[model samples]
Target: MNHHKITSDHLQKKAYVYVRQSTLGQVLHHQESTDRQYALKDKALTLGWNEKEIRTLDRDLGMSGAQSEKREDFKTLLADVSLGEVGAVLALEASRLARSNTDWHRLIELCSLTGTLILDEDGVYDPADFNDGLLLGIKGTMSAAELHFLRGRLQGGKRNKAERGELRFPLPVGLCWDEAGGIVLDPDQEVQGAVWMVFRLFQETGSAYGVAHQFAAKGLKFPKRAYGGVWDGKLIWGHLTDSRVLSILKNPAYAGVYAFGRFRCVKEILQDGQIRQRVRKMPRDSWLVEIQNHHEGYTTWNEYLANQDQLERNRTQRPENILPQAAREGLALLQGLLVCGKCGRRLTVRYQGNGGIYPIYECNWRKREGRSKRSCMFLSCPPLDQAVAERVLAAVSPEQLQLALAAQDELLARDGSLRRQWEMRLQRAQYEADLAQRRYEQVDPDHRLVAASLEARWNKALAQVDEVRRQMEEFCRQQTRTFTEQQRQQILGLANDFPRLWRESATSAKDKKRMLRLLLEDITVERGADREVQLHVRWTGGACEDLTVTLPARIQDRLRYPAERIDEIRRLATEHTDAQIAALLNKRGQRSSRGKRFTGKMIGWIRYKHRIPAVELKRPDERTVAEVASRFGVSHGVVYYWIDRNILPARQQAANRPHWITLTDAKARELQDWVQSSKRIAKRSLKRQSA
Candidate 1:
């Protein structure tokens, strides 16, 4: 028993008994093992150590000794031994201290230096002695090797059971054990319905987060199975979280497959110089066992694989640049589907205008890489979106009739859900009204105080019932007011008329954007010669369509005006003022070559540029304000109103003098008509207000 290892010097110092259990389950259920470890304190006292000198460390009771980092009690014991404070280190076995050589050897080295004795049920060993040290080293090595063998055997058993679809773990929501102890769908219809709804919605929306959002919007909760104690296996309802939805979606079990080893333990060194373990997901192919069609499930294995692919594609931050992302609720129809032909990079969408109604597609790849702005590819969204939409409509016209019928069915289904909600509200209100009336009738009329309150409550409840009834009637009326047979026929007739449908208020921008993403894989735009943009459309099936689209020229892009228009403008500048020239040019439909309507300022600019002389209006026949007003059969104020509004031109000789108005008979007639039109509008507005 190595009695020589125990010395008086060791008895003078404290004895540290390190106790641990590998798991919480063992700590709770394996009380005998814990008692055995703690009984080592009596062993230390039997070895001539006083009761006060014996200290038990059970802080690592629910922690694994396979790694030393998590064992704080073990660390404290080692520190005391290294500081020459712990004279004897006692444990139930070497494995209880550590199953790793790094930890065991370190503790042994510290004990050897501190002249501490190691004790267990077998015997006591002094690490300073060569024979005992060698034996303890063997014990430590064997302990670590035993752990490896035990783990391998357990893992092998698990894999075998999983391959046979017999291994059991915590089932996700909607699955539970049957009376016969076999896995089956949850007996609760609501739980089963919720689980099925999540899968159905994911199928419809092609997004896990979208499914959670749908549940939240509908005020529906997801069921989670409680794991332990009184609540074990019970269903707990909560608002569905995105991660929970994703977990459900990603689990192979939901697809009737038994899969194991989806995750692997990884060791990481933390900032505190300790090892940490994390469970990281492994690739599906790397899973140790996968048995398909193991049980009844919500989806097929093939559908599960498709869902995985879809989720991968839906990621906006994929490292690979080739994959397209899900459609965002942005104004740009081609937001995630556009690419720059010149740069071979994705184009970013920038929204402008009030409410971000206008979208601009720009390639900022080079700019992001710190290149000059000249490398950017820019295109206004309206023209490009129109061009692409026209092409898409042409490509999809054959299926438009089928899609229209399906859309009509979807609308009816949505209305059915809404109608059910209204009906529920109506029923609730009717019940309240009936209850209030019954309560009022039961009240004694002579007790006026209570009778009055009950009557008022009854009246309020009646009002609520009426409001709900009216709302239900309105809803029913709206449901009945669907598209007429003739309208349906017209819609069918114009199934291929996408332009008209796109412009219709019934079509949402979101639906349009989703439609574009579904049809087109990517559109590459490159600047071409002669103010044209070359659009290379890659359709979903790898079909490519190339089109040359003309970019609208800006006013500044016009090199010069036509020589004939220029000569007319110059001549008009000679006899007419700038204002008169503009009016005359506009009346003759002689707009600027840039397609802008001529204004007085534009006329002056052209006249000044060409060195044209200003016109002189000094003739006696030129009518002044009072003369013009008399001629127009209107007041002086009306004439002045027309002049102020630029309908007529007037000049002043001095601030105090009357304004001189020059008017041809045509001008005088236009003024009279404008004044009469304004009066009629004002009179009509007054009549409407009074009515």
Candidate 2:
């Protein structure tokens, strides 16, 4: 009955045996399952195939049978089976080959077409037989359903454990698992101090990079514990990187909270048809598990939340929301704090002029997006900065004394922190040296192999101690001498009478921006009247203030004379000449809008701009060329001929103006007689003796 379906033709092919496990952990712990799978080689040998022809596929061990996509050796097995190279496929159970119905049915179909025999602990059967094929189909379906049941149960257990805050995981640097299976602060005092100092400096600087800068300036090292290696359960000290600072800040374990699933992996298909998993950080409310106050914390829960907010505020180029960007180098005091009330978008700053001496703020979102042709508004830097500074100074004036005293205390505390870090480092080195000394003394000198090693280790530890001591000495040498108590009191006495520290050169523009962000949520600006703007300042606690600041006129408007100045010039123009008007303006101490003394050309330009007529200063006897020609009863050519011959005295108002001729009754009568006597005008003049 075992070989009922096995034929002589099938016995000519080789036999195949497949082995697999669902996970690496299962492969390590479940030896019986692996042994059972390997024992199938014997089954293959007995199923009408020679021992030399029996091949085993063990490369697929410790890999899941759920999918054939990533299983290389399993793919080889399928290739051989479909090629009719296999007389029989042997496993302890058919389900070991695949846990998915699709893969299981495919293998069964290939065997049936190739007329191969299937062998398991149950019995030997040919998939070509109708009864055996039907039975194999039932087993394939059962195998896939069993995987679902197993996966659901395993996941349910994990969720139950996590919900109770009992799921054990690796803790962050400041906390560790004690021998009693409870979370406790690290026993290393230096490590604890370094961690606490990071939180404190972050609060002071309000940026992650600033925290790292503090560590670098202090010449301090940060500690990280190793996991799952030869150096496991040991502290590793090295340079504190910005990325590490962010990791420490983002971790909830440092805040004494048990959190799970703060991040999750999502699978996506690339454009090239390959699949990849990307890790995305989930928001706080989206975390799967959270247990507050689960252990001692470096900061309170509220403080942790505040740190997150501060970190968010420090990011730039995040064009959404009303959060102000981190303070950076630039002269734009309202860099990230200004919002356009018209379009409700953030205003951008642009530096202009020679050497970028001028900064202008404007909102051009719609213009950039091609939705509008005009910008919302623009304001020059000086006036706007001065206005904001006035408001800020008035608000902060009442806190000067307190702020100055706090600054002194903060400075002292910063120095003390550095000294304490160095001291702790030296103490830890001393203890390590002492431990090495004890180990060396406990060893016997007769056993040279062990004693030599211990002695060398002791010497190395002592060298470390000496090196740290020298470093501390150098640090102390570089530190400024402390002021006497009386001197400190004298310095403090100027605190109340001191000027606004915010306006002093000691305060940089970046610091001013940071302070401004702390006090004001946002300043919304909209265009008001011509050359004016409305600033709606929103304080941190929901208080609002309105400020109206007049912007300087545009370049075209500023250079042109004012309306009243032009009117005064026009009233002066009807009575005085260009030169006379210039002299009159100089006498009255009236200067042009450009802060220069007005000249005749300046008055002429004002006339051109306003289209005002200049005064007629020509004398009644000083007639124009046309009037002289008419009085002499001759054409204008005859008059010009007389002037060209110096017979007529003519004057011009500069080169471009018209010419004037001098004429009197005696000269006119003589000119009329000469014109009648001149033969050139006798033929053209009607008043001549036309007869």
Identify the candidate with maximal TM-score: 1
> Model 2, range 1-691, lDDT digits (tens) per residue?
2376777776788878888888888899998899989988776666557788888888888777777767877788778889988888887886788988888888888999988777788987778889999999888889888988998898788778988888788888989888877788998999999899899988888888989999999999999999987999899999998899999998888888989889887878779765556899999999999999988888888888988888887776554545677787789999878898988888888899999868889888888889899998777877888898788666555455357557657866787899999999999999999999999999988999999999999999999999999999999877645766787666565443334667588889898888788778999988887778899999886779999999877888889777888888899999987878899999999888888998999999889978999888788767887887666567787787888888888887665667788877787787778767867676677654363
Q: lDDT tens digits, residues 199-224, model 1?
A: 89987777888898899999999888
Scanning candidate 2 in windows of ten residues, the lowest lDDT window is: 491-500
Regions more than 4 Å wrong, model 2 = 1-18, 29-32, 35-58, 65-70, 74-141, 272-275, 342-381, 396-499, 559-691
lDDT, residue 89, candidate 2 = 83
lDDT of each: 0.81, 0.83
Top candidate (lDDT):
2
Off by over 4 Å in 1: 1-12, 126-132, 179-182, 340-345, 352-358, 362-378, 396-494, 525-532, 552-691
For candidate 1, report its TM-score. 0.66
